[model samples]
Target: MSAWHRPSSRRDLFRFAASAAACAALPGLARANQRPEAFTSGEIVENGHRFFGSISRGLAEGLEQANKKWGRPNAYILGQEAGGAFVGGLRYGEGKMFTRNAGQKPVFWQGPSIGLDAGADGDRTMMLVYNLPDVEAIYRRYAGVNGSAYLVGGLGFTALNNEEVVVMPVRAGLGARLGLALSYLKFTPDSTWNPF
Candidate 1:
Protein backbone atom coordinates (compact mmCIF):
# COMPACT_ATOMS: atom_id res chain seq x y z
CA MET A 1 0.00 0.00 0.00
CA SER A 2 1.05 3.61 -0.62
CA ALA A 3 2.33 5.76 2.28
CA TRP A 4 -0.98 7.67 2.22
CA HIS A 5 -2.98 4.45 2.79
CA ARG A 6 -0.70 1.96 4.49
CA PRO A 7 -2.10 -1.18 6.17
CA SER A 8 -1.88 -1.13 9.94
CA SER A 9 0.92 -3.31 11.35
CA ARG A 10 0.95 -5.57 14.43
CA ARG A 11 2.65 -2.82 16.48
CA ASP A 12 -0.22 -0.48 15.58
CA LEU A 13 -2.67 -3.20 16.60
CA PHE A 14 -0.93 -3.54 19.98
CA ARG A 15 -1.07 0.20 20.56
CA PHE A 16 -4.76 0.26 19.64
CA ALA A 17 -5.46 -2.62 22.03
CA ALA A 18 -3.63 -0.87 24.86
CA SER A 19 -5.60 2.36 24.30
CA ALA A 20 -8.89 0.45 24.17
CA ALA A 21 -8.10 -1.35 27.42
CA ALA A 22 -7.33 1.91 29.21
CA CYS A 23 -10.48 3.56 27.86
CA ALA A 24 -12.59 0.58 28.93
CA ALA A 25 -11.27 0.84 32.47
CA LEU A 26 -12.26 4.50 32.86
CA PRO A 27 -15.87 3.79 33.90
CA GLY A 28 -14.69 1.22 36.42
CA LEU A 29 -12.25 3.74 37.81
CA ALA A 30 -14.94 6.37 38.13
CA ARG A 31 -17.18 3.94 40.05
CA ALA A 32 -14.28 2.94 42.30
CA ASN A 33 -13.71 6.58 43.21
CA GLN A 34 -17.31 6.81 44.47
CA ARG A 35 -17.82 5.87 48.11
CA PRO A 36 -20.39 3.11 48.49
CA GLU A 37 -22.46 5.08 51.01
CA ALA A 38 -22.26 8.50 49.40
CA PHE A 39 -26.02 8.90 49.23
CA THR A 40 -26.75 7.47 52.69
CA SER A 41 -24.03 9.43 54.47
CA GLY A 42 -23.74 12.71 52.64
CA GLU A 43 -26.05 15.71 52.33
CA ILE A 44 -27.41 16.80 48.97
CA VAL A 45 -24.35 17.31 46.77
CA GLU A 46 -26.14 17.95 43.48
CA ASN A 47 -28.09 21.18 43.06
CA GLY A 48 -30.83 19.14 41.42
CA HIS A 49 -32.10 17.92 44.80
CA ARG A 50 -32.95 21.43 45.99
CA PHE A 51 -35.05 22.06 42.90
CA PHE A 52 -36.83 18.74 43.32
CA GLY A 53 -37.93 19.58 46.88
CA SER A 54 -39.19 23.05 45.98
CA ILE A 55 -41.13 21.75 42.98
CA SER A 56 -42.68 19.00 45.08
CA ARG A 57 -44.12 21.57 47.45
CA GLY A 58 -45.43 23.67 44.56
CA LEU A 59 -47.16 20.70 42.91
CA ALA A 60 -48.84 19.75 46.18
CA GLU A 61 -50.33 23.22 46.45
CA GLY A 62 -51.06 24.05 42.80
CA LEU A 63 -52.54 20.72 41.79
CA GLU A 64 -54.61 20.03 44.88
CA GLN A 65 -57.88 19.58 43.02
CA ALA A 66 -56.35 17.21 40.49
CA ASN A 67 -54.82 15.19 43.29
CA LYS A 68 -58.19 14.83 45.03
CA LYS A 69 -59.94 13.95 41.78
CA TRP A 70 -57.51 11.15 41.04
CA GLY A 71 -58.17 9.70 44.51
CA ARG A 72 -55.06 7.61 44.08
CA PRO A 73 -51.90 9.47 43.20
CA ASN A 74 -49.53 6.60 42.39
CA ALA A 75 -47.55 7.88 39.49
CA TYR A 76 -45.61 10.80 40.96
CA ILE A 77 -42.85 9.98 43.43
CA LEU A 78 -40.09 11.96 45.06
CA GLY A 79 -37.03 9.77 44.80
CA GLN A 80 -33.66 9.93 43.12
CA GLU A 81 -32.42 7.58 40.51
CA ALA A 82 -28.67 7.61 39.90
CA GLY A 83 -28.23 8.68 36.31
CA GLY A 84 -25.15 8.84 34.12
CA ALA A 85 -24.45 10.43 30.77
CA PHE A 86 -26.27 8.60 28.00
CA VAL A 87 -26.21 8.00 24.26
CA GLY A 88 -29.24 8.13 21.94
CA GLY A 89 -32.15 10.02 23.64
CA LEU A 90 -32.70 10.62 27.35
CA ARG A 91 -35.73 8.35 27.58
CA TYR A 92 -34.04 5.50 25.74
CA GLY A 93 -30.89 5.90 27.79
CA GLU A 94 -32.81 6.00 31.07
CA GLY A 95 -34.81 2.92 30.13
CA LYS A 96 -31.65 1.08 29.20
CA MET A 97 -29.98 2.08 32.46
CA PHE A 98 -32.94 0.84 34.57
CA THR A 99 -33.35 -2.38 32.61
CA ARG A 100 -29.68 -3.24 33.00
CA ASN A 101 -30.16 -3.75 36.73
CA ALA A 102 -32.32 -6.37 38.44
CA GLY A 103 -35.12 -5.75 40.99
CA GLN A 104 -35.50 -2.08 40.07
CA LYS A 105 -38.95 -0.51 40.40
CA PRO A 106 -40.23 2.23 38.11
CA VAL A 107 -41.81 5.54 39.17
CA PHE A 108 -43.82 7.84 36.89
CA TRP A 109 -43.94 11.48 37.89
CA GLN A 110 -43.79 14.68 35.86
CA GLY A 111 -42.94 18.17 36.99
CA PRO A 112 -39.98 20.24 35.80
CA SER A 113 -37.05 18.90 33.84
CA ILE A 114 -33.76 20.80 33.68
CA GLY A 115 -31.07 19.78 31.28
CA LEU A 116 -27.84 21.00 29.79
CA ASP A 117 -26.75 20.60 26.21
CA ALA A 118 -23.23 21.28 25.09
CA GLY A 119 -22.39 21.38 21.42
CA ALA A 120 -22.61 17.93 19.78
CA ASP A 121 -23.18 16.28 23.13
CA GLY A 122 -26.28 14.53 24.45
CA ASP A 123 -28.31 16.34 27.13
CA ARG A 124 -28.60 15.27 30.77
CA THR A 125 -31.97 16.00 32.40
CA MET A 126 -32.93 16.49 36.05
CA MET A 127 -36.65 16.15 36.78
CA LEU A 128 -38.60 17.47 39.77
CA VAL A 129 -42.06 16.33 40.89
CA TYR A 130 -44.38 19.15 41.99
CA ASN A 131 -47.35 17.09 43.11
CA LEU A 132 -46.91 15.37 46.48
CA PRO A 133 -49.78 12.98 45.85
CA ASP A 134 -48.07 11.79 42.68
CA VAL A 135 -44.82 11.61 44.57
CA GLU A 136 -46.39 9.52 47.32
CA ALA A 137 -47.97 7.13 44.87
CA ILE A 138 -44.65 6.57 43.11
CA TYR A 139 -42.92 6.02 46.43
CA ARG A 140 -45.47 3.48 47.63
CA ARG A 141 -45.42 1.57 44.37
CA TYR A 142 -41.63 1.45 44.27
CA ALA A 143 -41.49 0.24 47.85
CA GLY A 144 -44.08 -2.51 47.33
CA VAL A 145 -43.17 -3.76 43.89
CA ASN A 146 -40.56 -6.49 43.79
CA GLY A 147 -39.87 -6.83 40.07
CA SER A 148 -38.42 -4.27 37.69
CA ALA A 149 -40.59 -1.57 36.17
CA TYR A 150 -40.22 0.52 33.03
CA LEU A 151 -39.36 4.20 33.59
CA VAL A 152 -40.31 6.97 31.18
CA GLY A 153 -38.01 9.95 31.41
CA GLY A 154 -38.64 13.70 31.16
CA LEU A 155 -42.28 14.75 31.42
CA GLY A 156 -41.41 18.41 30.98
CA PHE A 157 -43.23 20.75 33.41
CA THR A 158 -44.70 22.67 30.50
CA ALA A 159 -45.99 20.96 27.41
CA LEU A 160 -44.45 22.49 24.29
CA ASN A 161 -47.15 24.11 22.16
CA ASN A 162 -49.65 21.88 23.98
CA GLU A 163 -47.92 18.81 22.54
CA GLU A 164 -44.28 18.30 23.47
CA VAL A 165 -43.06 18.08 27.03
CA VAL A 166 -42.06 21.39 28.59
CA VAL A 167 -38.36 21.79 29.32
CA MET A 168 -36.95 24.55 31.53
CA PRO A 169 -33.55 25.48 30.17
CA VAL A 170 -30.65 25.41 32.63
CA ARG A 171 -27.54 27.39 31.88
CA ALA A 172 -24.14 25.86 32.50
CA GLY A 173 -22.11 27.82 35.03
CA LEU A 174 -20.25 27.45 38.30
CA GLY A 175 -22.82 27.09 41.12
CA ALA A 176 -25.25 29.53 39.52
CA ARG A 177 -28.48 28.97 41.47
CA LEU A 178 -30.56 26.44 39.47
CA GLY A 179 -33.33 25.39 41.85
CA LEU A 180 -34.99 28.75 41.33
CA ALA A 181 -35.76 27.87 37.73
CA LEU A 182 -38.42 25.32 38.63
CA SER A 183 -41.51 25.53 36.41
CA TYR A 184 -45.03 24.56 37.46
CA LEU A 185 -47.23 22.25 35.41
CA LYS A 186 -51.00 21.90 35.56
CA PHE A 187 -51.89 18.39 36.67
CA THR A 188 -54.16 16.49 34.34
CA PRO A 189 -55.35 12.98 35.10
CA ASP A 190 -53.69 10.48 32.80
CA SER A 191 -56.40 8.94 30.65
CA THR A 192 -54.84 5.51 30.35
CA TRP A 193 -55.73 3.09 33.15
CA ASN A 194 -52.64 1.67 34.81
CA PRO A 195 -52.99 -1.63 36.65
CA PHE A 196 -50.50 -0.65 39.28
Candidate 2:
Protein backbone atom coordinates (compact mmCIF):
# COMPACT_ATOMS: atom_id res chain seq x y z
CA MET A 1 0.00 0.00 0.00
CA SER A 2 1.20 3.51 -0.74
CA ALA A 3 1.54 5.86 2.21
CA TRP A 4 -0.03 9.35 2.21
CA HIS A 5 2.27 12.21 1.18
CA ARG A 6 2.06 16.03 1.43
CA PRO A 7 0.85 17.78 -1.71
CA SER A 8 4.04 18.19 -3.73
CA SER A 9 3.24 21.05 -6.14
CA ARG A 10 1.70 24.42 -5.35
CA ARG A 11 -1.08 23.60 -7.84
CA ASP A 12 -1.92 20.42 -5.92
CA LEU A 13 -2.01 22.32 -2.63
CA PHE A 14 -4.24 25.03 -4.15
CA ARG A 15 -6.72 22.43 -5.43
CA PHE A 16 -6.82 20.77 -2.00
CA ALA A 17 -7.56 24.11 -0.33
CA ALA A 18 -10.37 24.88 -2.77
CA SER A 19 -11.97 21.49 -2.22
CA ALA A 20 -11.78 21.89 1.53
CA ALA A 21 -13.42 25.32 1.43
CA ALA A 22 -16.31 24.04 -0.71
CA CYS A 23 -16.88 21.12 1.63
CA ALA A 24 -16.95 23.41 4.66
CA ALA A 25 -19.52 25.69 2.99
CA LEU A 26 -21.92 22.89 2.01
CA PRO A 27 -23.84 22.66 5.29
CA GLY A 28 -24.38 26.40 5.61
CA LEU A 29 -25.62 26.56 2.03
CA ALA A 30 -28.11 23.73 2.61
CA ARG A 31 -29.57 25.39 5.70
CA ALA A 32 -29.84 28.73 3.89
CA ASN A 33 -31.82 27.17 1.02
CA GLN A 34 -34.44 25.38 3.10
CA ARG A 35 -38.04 26.53 2.25
CA PRO A 36 -41.06 27.23 4.40
CA GLU A 37 -44.03 24.90 4.59
CA ALA A 38 -47.07 27.24 4.54
CA PHE A 39 -48.95 30.41 5.64
CA THR A 40 -52.31 30.86 7.33
CA SER A 41 -55.13 33.34 6.62
CA GLY A 42 -55.15 34.61 10.18
CA GLU A 43 -51.42 35.24 10.02
CA ILE A 44 -51.89 37.08 6.75
CA VAL A 45 -54.47 39.46 8.15
CA GLU A 46 -52.64 39.91 11.42
CA ASN A 47 -49.38 40.65 9.69
CA GLY A 48 -51.07 43.03 7.26
CA HIS A 49 -52.25 45.16 10.15
CA ARG A 50 -48.97 44.82 11.97
CA PHE A 51 -46.77 45.58 8.97
CA PHE A 52 -48.65 48.66 7.79
CA GLY A 53 -49.49 49.81 11.31
CA SER A 54 -53.28 49.76 11.15
CA ILE A 55 -56.25 47.45 11.74
CA SER A 56 -58.85 49.06 9.49
CA ARG A 57 -61.96 47.27 8.31
CA GLY A 58 -60.97 47.84 4.70
CA LEU A 59 -57.62 46.16 5.34
CA ALA A 60 -59.34 43.18 6.93
CA GLU A 61 -61.72 42.84 4.03
CA GLY A 62 -58.89 43.13 1.54
CA LEU A 63 -56.88 40.37 3.17
CA GLU A 64 -59.97 38.18 3.32
CA GLN A 65 -60.50 38.74 -0.38
CA ALA A 66 -56.98 37.56 -1.22
CA ASN A 67 -57.38 34.58 1.08
CA LYS A 68 -60.47 33.50 -0.81
CA LYS A 69 -58.74 33.73 -4.16
CA TRP A 70 -55.62 31.82 -3.15
CA GLY A 71 -55.93 30.05 0.15
CA ARG A 72 -52.87 29.57 2.36
CA PRO A 73 -50.08 31.24 0.41
CA ASN A 74 -46.59 29.84 0.91
CA ALA A 75 -44.93 33.26 0.95
CA TYR A 76 -45.41 37.03 1.36
CA ILE A 77 -43.57 40.35 0.92
CA LEU A 78 -43.81 43.20 3.38
CA GLY A 79 -42.60 46.61 2.20
CA GLN A 80 -43.39 50.11 0.89
CA GLU A 81 -43.55 51.76 -2.55
CA ALA A 82 -43.94 55.10 -4.43
CA GLY A 83 -45.87 55.99 -7.59
CA GLY A 84 -48.36 58.50 -9.03
CA ALA A 85 -50.27 59.33 -12.17
CA PHE A 86 -52.54 61.64 -14.12
CA VAL A 87 -52.75 58.99 -16.80
CA GLY A 88 -49.60 56.89 -17.39
CA GLY A 89 -47.17 56.24 -14.54
CA LEU A 90 -44.32 54.24 -13.08
CA ARG A 91 -43.90 52.45 -9.74
CA TYR A 92 -40.97 51.20 -7.73
CA GLY A 93 -40.71 49.38 -4.43
CA GLU A 94 -38.41 47.29 -2.23
CA GLY A 95 -39.37 44.64 0.27
CA LYS A 96 -38.45 41.41 2.01
CA MET A 97 -40.02 38.10 1.04
CA PHE A 98 -40.74 36.11 4.18
CA THR A 99 -40.69 32.33 4.12
CA ARG A 100 -40.13 30.71 7.50
CA ASN A 101 -37.57 28.12 6.46
CA ALA A 102 -36.00 30.00 3.57
CA GLY A 103 -35.67 33.19 5.62
CA GLN A 104 -36.18 36.79 4.50
CA LYS A 105 -34.85 37.69 1.07
CA PRO A 106 -34.41 41.35 0.11
CA VAL A 107 -36.17 41.85 -3.23
CA PHE A 108 -36.74 44.95 -5.37
CA TRP A 109 -39.49 45.42 -7.97
CA GLN A 110 -40.54 48.09 -10.47
CA GLY A 111 -43.39 48.41 -12.95
CA PRO A 112 -44.61 50.90 -15.51
CA SER A 113 -48.32 51.47 -15.94
CA ILE A 114 -50.49 53.19 -18.50
CA GLY A 115 -54.04 54.52 -17.82
CA LEU A 116 -53.79 53.51 -14.15
CA ASP A 117 -55.66 55.32 -11.40
CA ALA A 118 -54.10 58.58 -10.23
CA GLY A 119 -53.51 58.75 -6.52
CA ALA A 120 -51.19 60.07 -3.82
CA ASP A 121 -48.23 57.89 -2.89
CA GLY A 122 -48.35 56.33 0.53
CA ASP A 123 -47.03 53.36 2.56
CA ARG A 124 -47.99 51.04 -0.28
CA THR A 125 -47.44 47.33 -0.63
CA MET A 126 -47.57 43.76 0.64
CA MET A 127 -47.67 40.88 -1.81
CA LEU A 128 -49.36 37.56 -1.15
CA VAL A 129 -47.52 34.89 -3.10
CA TYR A 130 -48.91 31.54 -4.20
CA ASN A 131 -47.42 28.36 -5.70
CA LEU A 132 -43.85 29.61 -5.44
CA PRO A 133 -41.82 26.39 -5.72
CA ASP A 134 -38.62 28.07 -4.56
CA VAL A 135 -36.90 31.39 -3.85
CA GLU A 136 -35.28 31.46 -7.30
CA ALA A 137 -38.79 31.69 -8.71
CA ILE A 138 -39.09 35.18 -7.20
CA TYR A 139 -36.25 36.60 -9.32
CA ARG A 140 -38.24 36.95 -12.54
CA ARG A 141 -40.74 39.24 -14.25
CA TYR A 142 -44.50 38.77 -13.74
CA ALA A 143 -47.45 40.11 -15.75
CA GLY A 144 -51.07 40.91 -14.94
CA VAL A 145 -53.79 43.46 -15.66
CA ASN A 146 -54.71 46.08 -13.11
CA GLY A 147 -58.04 47.54 -14.18
CA SER A 148 -59.95 47.72 -11.00
CA ALA A 149 -59.64 49.38 -7.61
CA TYR A 150 -60.36 47.53 -4.37
CA LEU A 151 -63.54 45.38 -4.62
CA VAL A 152 -63.35 45.01 -8.38
CA GLY A 153 -60.57 42.42 -8.39
CA GLY A 154 -59.97 41.82 -4.70
CA LEU A 155 -57.64 44.15 -2.77
CA GLY A 156 -55.17 45.99 -5.00
CA PHE A 157 -54.85 42.69 -6.71
CA THR A 158 -52.13 43.20 -9.26
CA ALA A 159 -52.22 39.48 -9.93
CA LEU A 160 -48.85 38.97 -11.60
CA ASN A 161 -47.51 35.60 -12.62
CA ASN A 162 -44.53 33.87 -14.18
CA GLU A 163 -45.27 30.24 -15.08
CA GLU A 164 -46.59 28.42 -12.00
CA VAL A 165 -45.90 31.20 -9.56
CA VAL A 166 -48.63 33.78 -8.78
CA VAL A 167 -48.01 37.11 -7.01
CA MET A 168 -50.89 39.33 -5.85
CA PRO A 169 -49.74 42.65 -4.48
CA VAL A 170 -52.01 44.08 -1.76
CA ARG A 171 -51.75 47.75 -0.92
CA ALA A 172 -52.56 48.96 2.58
CA GLY A 173 -52.73 52.70 1.91
CA LEU A 174 -55.01 52.47 -1.09
CA GLY A 175 -57.05 49.86 0.72
CA ALA A 176 -57.06 48.42 -2.83
CA ARG A 177 -56.39 50.15 -6.13
CA LEU A 178 -56.11 49.19 -9.78
CA GLY A 179 -57.08 50.58 -13.17
CA LEU A 180 -57.19 49.92 -16.91
CA ALA A 181 -53.45 49.62 -17.26
CA LEU A 182 -51.06 46.88 -18.30
CA SER A 183 -48.23 46.43 -15.78
CA TYR A 184 -45.26 44.12 -15.65
CA LEU A 185 -43.05 43.83 -12.59
CA LYS A 186 -39.44 42.75 -12.93
CA PHE A 187 -37.79 41.63 -9.71
CA THR A 188 -34.07 42.01 -9.24
CA PRO A 189 -31.58 40.93 -6.60
CA ASP A 190 -30.15 44.45 -6.52
CA SER A 191 -31.70 47.95 -6.62
CA THR A 192 -31.97 49.42 -10.11
CA TRP A 193 -33.48 52.61 -11.51
CA ASN A 194 -34.28 50.90 -14.80
CA PRO A 195 -37.87 49.60 -14.58
CA PHE A 196 -37.87 47.97 -18.00
Candidate 3:
Protein backbone atom coordinates (compact mmCIF):
# COMPACT_ATOMS: atom_id res chain seq x y z
CA MET A 1 0.00 0.00 0.00
CA SER A 2 2.85 2.34 0.76
CA ALA A 3 4.48 1.76 -2.68
CA TRP A 4 1.27 1.84 -4.72
CA HIS A 5 0.80 4.94 -6.87
CA ARG A 6 -1.67 6.44 -9.35
CA PRO A 7 -1.92 9.58 -11.54
CA SER A 8 -2.61 11.90 -8.58
CA SER A 9 -1.33 15.19 -10.07
CA ARG A 10 -3.03 17.28 -12.76
CA ARG A 11 0.15 17.20 -14.92
CA ASP A 12 0.36 13.36 -14.77
CA LEU A 13 -3.34 12.96 -15.67
CA PHE A 14 -2.98 15.33 -18.65
CA ARG A 15 0.00 13.35 -19.96
CA PHE A 16 -1.91 10.07 -19.72
CA ALA A 17 -4.91 11.52 -21.56
CA ALA A 18 -2.69 12.84 -24.37
CA SER A 19 -1.00 9.44 -24.85
CA ALA A 20 -4.36 7.62 -25.05
CA ALA A 21 -5.74 10.08 -27.61
CA ALA A 22 -2.71 9.60 -29.86
CA CYS A 23 -2.95 5.80 -29.70
CA ALA A 24 -6.67 5.94 -30.64
CA ALA A 25 -5.96 8.13 -33.69
CA LEU A 26 -3.17 5.91 -35.13
CA PRO A 27 -5.46 3.31 -36.79
CA GLY A 28 -7.46 5.93 -38.70
CA LEU A 29 -4.30 7.55 -40.06
CA ALA A 30 -2.97 4.21 -41.26
CA ARG A 31 -6.24 3.32 -43.01
CA ALA A 32 -6.41 6.66 -44.77
CA ASN A 33 -2.99 6.18 -46.38
CA GLN A 34 -3.41 2.54 -47.44
CA ARG A 35 -4.23 1.69 -51.06
CA PRO A 36 -7.49 -0.13 -51.76
CA GLU A 37 -7.56 -3.79 -52.65
CA ALA A 38 -8.15 -5.15 -56.17
CA PHE A 39 -11.47 -4.63 -57.91
CA THR A 40 -13.98 -7.42 -58.29
CA SER A 41 -14.96 -9.03 -61.61
CA GLY A 42 -18.47 -7.56 -61.60
CA GLU A 43 -17.10 -4.05 -61.06
CA ILE A 44 -14.69 -4.43 -63.95
CA VAL A 45 -17.38 -5.68 -66.34
CA GLU A 46 -19.82 -2.94 -65.37
CA ASN A 47 -17.29 -0.13 -65.72
CA GLY A 48 -15.86 -1.54 -68.96
CA HIS A 49 -19.00 -0.80 -70.90
CA ARG A 50 -19.65 2.35 -68.89
CA PHE A 51 -16.46 3.93 -70.23
CA PHE A 52 -16.38 2.29 -73.67
CA GLY A 53 -20.15 2.27 -74.28
CA SER A 54 -22.43 -0.66 -75.05
CA ILE A 55 -20.49 -3.19 -77.11
CA SER A 56 -21.61 -3.72 -80.67
CA ARG A 57 -22.12 -7.19 -82.12
CA GLY A 58 -19.02 -6.91 -84.25
CA LEU A 59 -17.02 -5.66 -81.33
CA ALA A 60 -18.28 -8.55 -79.22
CA GLU A 61 -17.20 -10.99 -81.89
CA GLY A 62 -13.83 -9.31 -82.07
CA LEU A 63 -13.49 -9.60 -78.30
CA GLU A 64 -14.29 -13.29 -78.52
CA GLN A 65 -11.63 -13.67 -81.19
CA ALA A 66 -9.13 -11.95 -78.95
CA ASN A 67 -10.07 -14.08 -75.97
CA LYS A 68 -9.72 -17.28 -77.98
CA LYS A 69 -6.49 -16.18 -79.61
CA TRP A 70 -4.90 -14.44 -76.65
CA GLY A 71 -5.66 -15.26 -73.02
CA ARG A 72 -8.22 -13.48 -70.84
CA PRO A 73 -7.17 -9.97 -69.88
CA ASN A 74 -6.91 -8.42 -66.45
CA ALA A 75 -7.51 -4.82 -67.56
CA TYR A 76 -8.67 -2.63 -70.45
CA ILE A 77 -8.29 0.86 -71.96
CA LEU A 78 -11.01 2.91 -73.68
CA GLY A 79 -10.06 5.62 -76.17
CA GLN A 80 -10.93 7.50 -79.37
CA GLU A 81 -8.80 8.87 -82.22
CA ALA A 82 -8.47 9.90 -85.88
CA GLY A 83 -5.58 9.27 -88.27
CA GLY A 84 -4.57 8.65 -91.90
CA ALA A 85 -1.63 7.54 -93.97
CA PHE A 86 0.09 8.13 -97.33
CA VAL A 87 3.53 6.53 -97.13
CA GLY A 88 3.81 7.29 -93.42
CA GLY A 89 0.95 7.38 -90.90
CA LEU A 90 0.40 8.69 -87.40
CA ARG A 91 -2.33 8.09 -84.82
CA TYR A 92 -2.93 9.77 -81.50
CA GLY A 93 -5.52 9.11 -78.84
CA GLU A 94 -6.52 9.79 -75.22
CA GLY A 95 -7.90 7.11 -72.95
CA LYS A 96 -8.24 5.67 -69.47
CA MET A 97 -6.75 2.47 -68.05
CA PHE A 98 -8.78 0.33 -65.64
CA THR A 99 -7.31 -2.52 -63.62
CA ARG A 100 -8.32 -4.85 -60.80
CA ASN A 101 -6.37 -3.04 -58.10
CA ALA A 102 -6.38 0.54 -59.33
CA GLY A 103 -9.70 2.13 -60.37
CA GLN A 104 -8.71 4.19 -63.40
CA LYS A 105 -5.95 6.47 -64.67
CA PRO A 106 -5.79 8.78 -67.69
CA VAL A 107 -3.50 7.62 -70.55
CA PHE A 108 -2.34 9.01 -73.89
CA TRP A 109 -0.87 7.07 -76.76
CA GLN A 110 0.60 7.92 -80.16
CA GLY A 111 2.44 6.07 -82.89
CA PRO A 112 3.69 6.13 -86.49
CA SER A 113 3.21 3.53 -89.20
CA ILE A 114 4.56 2.88 -92.69
CA GLY A 115 3.23 0.70 -95.48
CA LEU A 116 0.45 0.99 -98.08
CA ASP A 117 -1.83 2.22 -95.27
CA ALA A 118 -4.01 5.28 -96.02
CA GLY A 119 -7.35 7.04 -95.28
CA ALA A 120 -8.58 9.20 -92.37
CA ASP A 121 -10.69 7.48 -89.71
CA GLY A 122 -12.09 8.30 -86.28
CA ASP A 123 -12.98 5.46 -83.95
CA ARG A 124 -13.57 4.49 -80.36
CA THR A 125 -11.20 1.76 -79.16
CA MET A 126 -11.24 -0.67 -76.27
CA MET A 127 -7.88 -2.29 -75.60
CA LEU A 128 -7.96 -5.50 -73.60
CA VAL A 129 -4.77 -5.58 -71.56
CA TYR A 130 -3.22 -8.77 -70.25
CA ASN A 131 -0.46 -9.50 -67.72
CA LEU A 132 -0.63 -6.07 -66.16
CA PRO A 133 1.13 -6.15 -62.81
CA ASP A 134 -0.12 -2.63 -62.07
CA VAL A 135 -1.41 0.53 -63.73
CA GLU A 136 2.14 1.88 -64.19
CA ALA A 137 2.97 -1.21 -66.28
CA ILE A 138 0.91 0.34 -69.13
CA TYR A 139 3.21 3.35 -69.64
CA ARG A 140 5.51 1.86 -72.28
CA ARG A 141 5.85 1.10 -75.97
CA TYR A 142 3.76 -1.68 -77.49
CA ALA A 143 4.70 -2.89 -80.95
CA GLY A 144 2.24 -4.00 -83.62
CA VAL A 145 3.11 -6.52 -86.27
CA ASN A 146 2.76 -5.99 -89.99
CA GLY A 147 -0.27 -7.56 -91.70
CA SER A 148 -1.96 -8.61 -88.45
CA ALA A 149 -4.99 -6.32 -88.59
CA TYR A 150 -8.46 -7.84 -88.80
CA LEU A 151 -11.73 -6.09 -89.62
CA VAL A 152 -15.38 -7.10 -89.19
CA GLY A 153 -18.54 -5.08 -89.89
CA GLY A 154 -16.95 -1.61 -89.64
CA LEU A 155 -14.84 -2.63 -86.68
CA GLY A 156 -11.15 -3.61 -86.60
CA PHE A 157 -8.81 -5.03 -84.00
CA THR A 158 -5.11 -5.73 -83.68
CA ALA A 159 -2.93 -7.21 -81.00
CA LEU A 160 0.14 -5.46 -79.65
CA ASN A 161 2.76 -7.20 -77.56
CA ASN A 162 5.46 -5.98 -75.18
CA GLU A 163 7.13 -8.69 -73.15
CA GLU A 164 4.56 -10.37 -70.88
CA VAL A 165 1.91 -7.72 -71.54
CA VAL A 166 -0.41 -7.98 -74.55
CA VAL A 167 -2.91 -5.31 -75.66
CA MET A 168 -5.73 -6.14 -78.08
CA PRO A 169 -7.03 -2.87 -79.51
CA VAL A 170 -10.57 -3.07 -80.91
CA ARG A 171 -11.91 -0.16 -82.92
CA ALA A 172 -15.33 0.84 -84.31
CA GLY A 173 -15.10 3.64 -86.80
CA LEU A 174 -16.48 5.41 -89.90
CA GLY A 175 -14.03 5.38 -92.81
CA ALA A 176 -12.63 3.38 -95.72
CA ARG A 177 -9.05 2.18 -95.34
CA LEU A 178 -6.84 -0.54 -96.72
CA GLY A 179 -3.19 -1.31 -95.94
CA LEU A 180 -0.78 -3.20 -93.74
CA ALA A 181 1.78 -1.48 -91.55
CA LEU A 182 4.09 -2.08 -88.63
CA SER A 183 3.47 0.33 -85.76
CA TYR A 184 4.43 0.96 -82.15
CA LEU A 185 2.29 2.88 -79.64
CA LYS A 186 3.92 4.83 -76.86
CA PHE A 187 1.72 5.30 -73.79
CA THR A 188 2.48 8.45 -71.86
CA PRO A 189 1.28 10.28 -68.77
CA ASP A 190 -0.13 13.11 -70.95
CA SER A 191 -0.98 13.80 -74.58
CA THR A 192 1.86 14.73 -76.92
CA TRP A 193 2.27 15.48 -80.63
CA ASN A 194 5.71 13.85 -80.78
CA PRO A 195 5.44 10.43 -82.37
CA PHE A 196 8.57 8.54 -81.47
On lDDT, the leading prediction is 2
Q: At residue 158, give the lDDT of candidate 2.
A: 61
Model 1 scores worst on lDDT over the 10 consecutive residues at: 141-150
How would you order the candidates by lDDT, starting with the best? Answer: 2, 3, 1
**Pairs that collide, model 2:** 147-179
List where candidate 1 sits over 4 angstroms from the true fold.
1-51, 75-196
The prediction achieving the highest TM-score against the true structure is 2
lDDT of 3 by residue, 1-196 (tens): 5754577899989988898899999986664334434433345446555755665555556666666665567778888877777768998998887655556779999999998776667778778887776667788999985332334325677888899888878776766677888988889999899989
Model 1, span 12-114: residue lDDT tens:
8788788779999998666433322211101211333354433344333323433243232211212322222112111111211011112223443223222
The lDDT of model 2 is: 0.75
Alpha-carbon deviation at 195 in model 3, angstroms: 0.9
State the lDDT of candidate 2 residue by residue for 120-172, as single tens digits: 45546889888888776888999887655543223354688888788988765
Instruction: Count clashing pairs, candidate 2.
Output: 1
Q: Of the candidates numbered 2 and 3, which has the greater lDDT value?
A: 2
